[model samples]
Target: MKRMIVRMTLPLLIVCLAFSSFSASARAASEEKYWDHWIERHAQPLDASNASNKDLRFLKKVLKGKRIVQLGETTHGAGEINATKVRMIKYLHEELGYDVLAFESGFPDTNASYLNMDQLTPKSTMKNSIYAVWHTEDVVELFDYMKEQKEKGDPLILTGFDIQSMKNSFNVAATQWVKAVDPEKAELLSQSENDFSTLVTDSNTFDEFSQKKEKLVKNYQKLIKFTKTHASELKENLPKEPKAYEMFMHSLQLRIDVMETYMLEEMKEKLEEYPENIEDFSFFMRDRMMAEQFQWVADTLYPKKKIIVWGHNYHLRKQNTKMIKDWVQLNGPNMGDYLPERLKKQTYTIGIYAYSGASLDSSDNKTVKPVTSPPPSGSLEALLKAADRPAVFVDFLHTKNKKGTSWMYTPRTALYWGYMEEQMILKEQYDGVIWLEHITPSVIIK
Candidate 1:
């Protein structure tokens, strides 16, 4: 009788605790939603005074001196009404005394050998892989202003990845030319190899801008026509020496492809050196880009200078710190873990994120859901590790909501049914990161 009573009471006690915890989490989420409502409810522009003294104090702490402050937004802003962005910048420069202005459109760390972010120019106003031409307005506006400052002698130490066509061993200069006797005959395709060289060498000497543009068009046309003629003759002779002919053509076409068109690049050849699978590819690239960026910043930019960096919130997401994990554990003279001897621990990385995105909820990508009060700041695996009082709740509540599955119920039905793998990819390395979520996406799924 005594054993039976103890067994039954223990389960009842567990059910009660779970019920209370769920209720607390739900209430905390509701409070977050309410505060967010108050923050954005105002239509007034974000001004210096609109921010609190605490805001500036925090800014000062985060961005004092040559610290790198990276603000990652998925896309550029629109129109003149980007109040939030404008205010954010103002707080950094004015309150924090930040001297350098950096951009995520390019590299944020002061690494000269850093690989520049690729700038894709769309053929039209639409979007594509290589060029996000339409979204380029923000980059153009920001860089144009910076370039103007450089020209005025109030220069900034501007650094980022350049988006020039790497395929071109020679760029616009290869196609642009100097003047000939007249427009039509002068612009004619040059069959003379020396003429092509001369044109590219002295293209700047061409007075009229139109003259330079016309030369480029003619240069490509000439090459294309010449290739077509040669390829036809080779085809007729191909039955006897097809392999040799094909090899010759391949070499020739490659030249034109690089210096002329925006065709498929050498990603395949590069990929060939790595695992072909997507999981392997993503992890490999993530590590490679992260390492390359780190080496470029620390070694190339400043051997003995203090710096700051802003990157994707993902880089600093404490719970899901996948990007920097391998790098942190990396032990070497030039690894993320290895601080330079000259620098005695002034280096730090801070992550900032708005806890807003189409995350756990299946709704609009930009939809804002409530931020549940954080679970008692315990690792998800802690319950498995410590089994004194609380029973593990991995599958205890999966059937409570179809859209939002709690880790309680549905898990036991299937082996390894949790999103543990995806979640682990998110939590890895960081100093301290802030979680914020905006509540003003066009739709809210209550």
Candidate 2:
């Protein structure tokens, strides 16, 4: 009787195991079917030119009533991503009425270049104002496009929202503004200008910068206080350029705030407080300042105009990941994360990624680094690559909570220069994603 009972139990256990295996296989097939259908239903093919911009018509519905649209790249060195962004910028400008194109570049230099865009060629304007990392052939094409539109009487105003003075252009531009506004006060700014130029261009490390931090802070404070004290007179002096005056004053204040924040980070280290990783304070402050600059653009400068923002995915992502939280415990919010609730509601962000490609190394922008391996199996890039499209844009807003695509809600990694990091909830991080099956390094403009 015991032997018979044992035999029966063993057979039943085998049957249960077989059924479980069948169920797992069936679930995987269903998921695959869902993803295939979803891609076919929603993926928009990316066109490189505005001539066939009908492919981008879907954006009209997705971005309806949006005031600010942010286009972000995984890295700064992808040629295809830059080309695709230019096409989107054209559509946003012509079809959607986004007239302002703000970059992740120097606030002072970019505005000065825009003010004198008529006198300068596109290449010169880009070279003098924007960061060298973005000095690519594809971006040059954008400057050319902006020039063409200005000629056609549909001007796309160029500006930037960064606090860091990337070049000496800022020093020249800022000093000129002060001289034009108040000649007597111009010398006060000149001192600060020289100090800042040295801080940005000469100091290569925090250690080097620390030695000059006190003097730089003192000079910047004096200049900022002087500017505030004579604000009304300065505005009156620039009667014909009230908006420019306001922006100039605000840029000066922001620069000082950035300097003070760096000083605070150094102080924290000296005090032996939050000693785990004090650099996070400076990183957080930079993004916070960037968000403030963007807000000033959206609310103060271009209140009625639609704006387009171009920047890195790391800076523009609205959501924070476990990695970021762990890494930046003191203050980890990104530029997008710092945006006010009202502006966030009216904003749409798109993150661009690639499954496989080579990119210019971020360290030097000259070294070519080939993608040594395919995207991880569960990454967002891998999922998109499985769709087998050369390039496609997937709208995360509409696809959430759908059948067979629950993977959208789950944590997954995304490719960054052919590498993966800790998983993040992709749907939360971006409103949409543009995936390139393959990419090449940006052609750096010499």
Candidate 3:
């Protein structure tokens, strides 16, 4: 009887100890499940301080046989993430043979142009010409990295609609569209086109937009020539004169002309309105171009490769995979929904975050802020405003101040609160998502 009792007690004690340990771990890991710190900190690598050694080890450990890594936003906000990224990239290319870096910040056509060595020569009207020449921060970093990779005889692939221009193409497209909807308005649209065209022609500064890259210059010239040829065909087919928005197959040519022309200026203009010209630009990129173009290039370029696009979170959404997902379940094109079940989790991942601890509003910080996701049906803006106890309006309507100090820009504060009450105003999707893992010296730690 004594021996049996001792055995029973020993078993009970072991069970109790196991339970206690699990409870502690559960408590600790609850944050990883709840808060997005680990993912967020990934924007900068933990091995940053000793990047050369750390990055090499990291690549070997994590990305040994990656086929695609569409994005890696290692800007780390304000601190210097470039050098660290360069080191990691060198490791990726030199050691692991991850050779390509695909950029979605440009149009596929532009990719062909860049490859062809097009001379930019931007028009005074099209603003993207400037950024294209000067290049945005990310663009510049990518260019530098690409150049270095090439010096090492490595391959690089670039893709995407050139920023605001994609969003801005809708304006020009709308002109053609509107004319189709209303026959009577053909003459009016023609007048608008004549006016816009005359302005473009008169602007000698049009050539001021230089095609810095040879491939881009060649592409531009090709597009210009294509536009002129297409314009003549559209004129020939139209009744009297082509109405601005005629729904004919030939109108695609007109659409392309409008896109390339506006591409020249979308970023140059101040476009804060909903029905603005910029919207026209965006529509052209989203609605007309084949998303397959980018996907095909990515598939070929990667081929058992691991890459990091460094694009906005929206592009990564594997959930609502395609622009057409809202309409079709299994049909049409949407990468977000089509990822294999295993890859789905990583592929369609996204990180919803609050980027604190930095002066996030600088023009240089353009890559970080604006929260990638748009205000969902005005809910984000609405909820943010309503929850703001001391809500401040800047110019009243269109934009509300975040809170505390309205000097140059309003700072975002506790508005992330609404997500708690299940009253979260908006729920945006993410693809290949993770949050910042650690607070860097450049940003403040909340």
Candidate 4:
């Protein structure tokens, strides 16, 4: 009698285990279906030349009342991401009222491009001011569109917020502006420009910059002094371009602050036997300054206009902490994280990610290689792909709290710089995400 009872109980236990597995699978399918309902499947990532805004009409509601929209990419070398950004930028400028398009590039260089847009060709303006990583055919098309719009009486302003100097545009623009106002004072600026240019072109790393810290600091100080002393004359001479002069002064001061911060971090690294949080010191300073520079653009430069920010995902995400190498902690707050409360309330961040295929790896900006891989199991990219869409935009901010979308609130793996997986809560990091089923290398223009 005891053996018969045990046999019947074992069968009952097996049936219960089978039912549990089936129920879990059913829940997962239900969750995926829920995500599918919120996914905008009609949108396509097209460049300005090929885009039609009918599919993008959805953005009007998504970005309503948002003064600044930051567009982020997984890497700098994805062709689809660049094309998608150009299309969105065109939509923002034409359909919406966003007039300023800011980049993650040199402040002075990009402004110089804007001031001289009529004199310089679109391609030349892009190459001279924007960073080389963005020197792609897609961006050139967008530049062409900007010029076209300018010719038609509507203008889209181009600017940047980075502290690092780019090319020789800053040096040329600074000296020329001073000469036009006060010829005698131009000599002092020219000398500082010469020194600063050497520091910009010669140094590509922290150690190199550290070696020239004293000279770098001195040059910026002298430049700042000249700008302050002759502010009246400079503004008076350029009545039509008063904002230009103001921004130039702001750039000089911001650059010096950034350099000083770097120098202090370097000093600590050298003096301390064990620097506890030295690994991310420069990144912290850079991101903080970038945020401040962006704020200046919004509040001071284009106070009444909506703005678009173009940058990498790592720099634009809202979260402050991340784990590197699965052990080491990264506590550096990104540019988005450092944004002021006022701006944060009106900002919408969108991150670009790919499900599979090769991304161009131009880490050194010299030789390009391909990083080919598929999304790992249980990654955000994988989950999006499971929705069975070639391309989609998930509006996490609006849908994450809905029933069956609880998966978005939990930590999940996502591809980051160099296609490495990092775990983050999707809804917390970005307002929305553009996911591509496959991506190819960006067309690098020579």
RMSD of each: 18.6, 7.6, 18.5, 8.1
For all candidates in order, the CA lDDT equals 0.32, 0.76, 0.35, 0.74
Instruction: Give the per-residue Cα lDDT of candidate 4 at 154.
Output: 84
C-alpha lDDT of residue 54 in model 1: 46
Better of 1 and 3 by lDDT: 3
**TM-score per candidate:** 0.37, 0.82, 0.41, 0.82
Tens digits of lDDT, candidate 4, 244-288: 787778767766675577445644445442346633576576788
Worst 10 residues of 4 by lDDT: 322-331
For 162-191, candidate 2 gives per-residue lDDT tens digits of 877764676666666678767666776666
How do these models rank on TM-score, best leading?
2, 4, 3, 1
TM-score: the better of candidates 3 and 4: 4
Candidate 1 residue lDDT tens string, 112-198 = 111111121111111111112212333334434434444475433333321122222222111222121223322343232233333
Estimate candidate 3's alpha-carbon lDDT, on a 0 to 1 scale: 0.35
Candidate 2, which ten residues in sequence have the lowest lDDT sum?
322-331
Sorted by lDDT, highest first, which candidate order results? 2, 4, 3, 1
Looking at model 1, residue 356 earns an lDDT score of 23
Predicted candidate 3 versus true structure: per-residue lDDT over 336-370, tens digit per residue: 43344544322313222322222133244343332
In terms of lDDT, the best-performing candidate is 2
